[model samples]
Target: MDKQELGAFLRTRRERLRPEDVGLVSGARRRTPGLRREEIAVLAHISTEYYVRLEQGRAPRPSGDVLAGISAALLLTDAESEHLHLLAGTAPIQTGLHRRDVRPSILTLLERLTQTAGFVTSATFEVLAWNDLAAALMEDFGALAPADRNLARKVFLVSDGDGRGGPLYGISDRAEFRQTVVMRLRTTMARYPSDPAVIGLVEELRSGSAEFARLWERHDVQSVPMLTKTFRHPVVGDVTVDCDSLALTDRDQHLVLYSAPQGSRDAEALALLSVLGTEGIDMVPDARR
Candidate 1:
């Protein structure tokens, strides 16, 4: 990543905020436009020299606590705080447990959501496990390769020839949507920098798509829980689905649910999903061809 640019951008953002923005009062005769380095250091409970070192890119690693302190002192946005942690190279701290081995109860919980399309995803956006409805709603989910089953990767790589992969639920503004996904992936990467899987996926995307690279450099972070999306299904035709993402508090896993909009034709299409399930049909293919 662009460490120098990150350092400079953070310093610039920190210097652009006024004391009043963070509920601090500034006395008269201050020469600078923003909080002074010493003042910020005091607020963050760090030495001026250390904070200076951080701004100068001399500090190799800063703890999450320190980064949080500085984030608060600077009144940073969520995206900015996440970016700060990434620049500090201390993000995505593991909790000393294998995320892949989360409680079996979660799997049971997913099975209970029969009417809705649901699945549990890892922090790196891998679809670790999914339910029947999820598989039927999105044909691509059924077609994901074992190694390339990632949301960000699918969004960028799964496309029709000539660079148009069709629309994500007939959404005309796909470029913005793609960028949003990239930003979220970048944020996740920042938090889990040591995850080789996550790193490798990013490197692959960078090499494959210039658009992804440009958006990654912007460093945007967002947590969108609920959205309405349309999908053009080969069998059912066009369907509008309401997608929701819920965080599993017990683990670093997220449960994603997809539902059809009430009173819409898609809702009728979803009803067919249960019939498919009852027939013992495995909608997801054993492999992507």
Candidate 2:
């Protein structure tokens, strides 16, 4: 195991974080940028001396539980999390190969959802196929370059007018949205370490958006909830709909359907969006940012 590299990596990860990131009160007089070793130790339930040994490259290899605690404390990304295992000489975590191809039946399902805003995405969140309602509601994925048909990159890099990007699907609760996207991307990274699409997207986002970089470092992971989401469209106004994700079994592709209940204002907005078609619709602009 590369003990020295592990120590250095851990130290660097720690230094990049601020106290407020982990719920600690920031002291004005502190000299360094991140949490102290003692604070990390306390958070990890380890002794200060043990953690110091870890940083000094003298400590024995850490167990899985110990690594998990450390990972949580430092907020390592999926890549960072796996790298920690290799450096620690432990068994690698299994983020098995993710399926990228969309099944025929899934495509049929997407097409059948005429009243709903529907689309299919690869494991890496690449926009594979989207309907007219989706295009009208959000940006036109079909018009985007195949390489640019990525959700994470659009969320983090694309701008409406200024350098900063516009709101995602006009969702106002941005923090929650960012967290959800980042978490899912991390899971995908773990599952497909060698995927050029996922890796390139990661590199692009890290270089482009400081916010994405910070969120990526946090290493959040979870299932995207089957919850109702609100979208504030420029033409149709506001529409709230339930977002449902259906996995295409072994194919690993996802069919995402957005639907509002009948007779609801959101349903009306969706209808208006369909009628509006491609008019008053613009997607992630320039992308030079």
- Candidate 2 residue 172 Cα shift, in angstroms, is 2.1
Flag clash pairs in model 2: 159-165
Model 1 agreement with the true structure over 1-289: per-residue lDDT tens digits:
4366456656676678787877888789888777788888888999999888777777667777888898888778786776776666566455233265546887787788777778877766677888777776654454557566666676676664658433443443466668767866666666556677777888988888877887776545654443776665545656677878887755677788878766777778887865665232343343222
lDDT of 2 by residue, 54-128 (tens): 989999999889988998888877657776776676855335556666777767777777799998887777788
- Per the 3 Å backbone cut-off, how many clashing residue pairs does candidate 1 have? 6
Clash totals for all candidate models: 6, 1
Q: Which sections of candidate 2 miss by over 4 Å?
A: 1-98, 161-164, 223-226, 279-289
Candidate number with greatest TM-score: 1
Candidate 1 off by > 4 Å: 1-56, 60-74, 82-92, 95-98, 140-144, 162-173, 223-226, 261-263, 277-289
